[model samples]
Target: MTRRVLRTLLPAAALVWTAAVGPAAAAVPLPIDAPLCGPAELERLDGLQADLDAKAAAGEAGRAQYWYVDPRACRLSVAVLRGAEDAHTEGFVGAALAASALPAPTSLTEVDEPVDRRIARVPAPAQRGARAAGTLHGGSAIYSGTSGLVYECTSGLNNYRPGTTTTAGHCADAATTWYDARGNRIGAVTDWRYPGTDWAVITPVAGWSLPNDVLGSTVPVARFGKASLGEAVCGRGATSGTRCGSVTAVNVTVNYPDGLVKGLVRSSQSGGEGDSGGPVYDGGTGLGLISGGASSGSPTFFQPLTF
Candidate 1:
């Protein structure tokens, strides 16, 4: 019965929070041509981000995908879904900054695409062992219960910490059990941090061996590293397959309908649903986990491994 229900509905685990409020101050939109932010600016931006989130909850302005401090432009950068921006947006941004006693945002970029958790629910295929990287590659399916409900997410790196692997926190919440492509009970989510961060560690069930290699790659993950601006990168997700792009920004704060996630790695790579928790790497070096992105062909964000 559970399988039947899961097979029919697309279940995505996300939380939503909303509030009501008033008008904001007036401001103008700035162009996006600045450099990425450094440490000091990132600190200031973090506090300001909290203020903006409060305004969003109070309905002072529409919700945003995320916001960050662009060091090059030396101003705040706010990202919203394409066509959602309007006159009131600028005002709201100005007001939010004033309330926080922070500098005004320099620009508001409309994300031509939408950002979302990469998970899908479809009919179950034949179950198999988790060792087959090709069949159960990075952008493969993750099953949660005996029911047909399954989350299509990209596979992350092997932690080598005995019976553990990594994925996006939103993919499997704490205490939630997961299964591999073959319907084998993988393990329960042991630890997870969301809203602030977006990564989770899963412990495999007894008798299951966790592989060191990513789903689609031939090289075994050696270690994790930090992402730099203009650094070449690539990501593998179940929905969009594998796509590569460059790191555009770091230390970003994304405001999902459910809540806010900070310290994200922004990139030019595009990803879609079912890509969450996939590995973001540069060759053999693991960098981060796919958090969300603009549709399937626009800039996406990831939860950095170092964070």
Candidate 2:
């Protein structure tokens, strides 16, 4: 009986669930008539999707759930299947263009498109890491979203429990590791908020300590004020470091590979991977958290810091 119980439990424990949030909005299907290449490009797009479906089904990739075709920008974004390895799907992007009259895509950008529905399943006390511009606060690389790098600040509660705890929405791409200044893994991400709002509260699991200081760190926080269109803002992230720009637009629909993000503020500040969940601030006031940027470098979108 003991051997049988062990055998059953081992297989059940071995299962790996590639978790993700659902689409922020309903699935907006890609129309066949969306217009890519003239008549010659259909096969290429179809073949690419076919290959993607195959790969996704086999767990080699996640579904390319969202895509956008903007003739004005001449840009096409396709969401890849799950797992970071699915990034390889972009490598085949050339094939998609082969069937199109459009010129071969000069570049392919990958962004997370987390949906609102999946937020509840996210772990708590999700772990993450950051590399500061330099040493500060008696040392660089503070753990929370508020040290090292300078960023826009906002005001809000951590998990929206009335007046429980106010927290920042910085630190995107929630991980499961307690990382050090030099990028060493110390813990794992226990919980995280992906799609709903950028705000997520992280608890210390596996014996990690939350930084006690708030000065001169990259940990994001809320300041004050409601941002408007064309408002100038500053942002700091683990990637692209610190940069200042203006809010280009608001209530924009951004399609991330993870899912759709609606009612987002679009900004001109440039951000890249590891920059997700960075603070979007109106001067010293916090505006939102970096969700994703436009496929082109035209603008960035962030989840407004609303508690």
Which numbered prediction scores highest in lDDT against the true structure?
A: 1
Model 2, residue 211: displacement in angstroms? 8.6
lDDT string, candidate 2, 1-307, tens digits: 0100011112212212111122122222335345445433434444444544444444333333333333322334343323445444544443343423333221133344332211111112233453332222111122322233322222222222322222223342433333344433333333445443455433323433333222334553434456675588766554455667887445443434444444566667765544454555654455665666533333566667554
- Prediction RMSDs, each to the true structure: 11.0, 17.3
Misplaced by over 4 Å in model 2 are 1-174, 182-191, 204-222, 295-297
Model 1, residue 106: C-alpha shift (Å): 1.6
Instruction: Report the CA-based lDDT of candidate 2 relative to the real structure.
Output: 0.40
Q: What is the C-alpha lDDT of each candidate?
A: 0.65, 0.40
Off by over 4 Å in 1: 1-47, 53-61, 83-91, 96-105, 128-140, 160-162
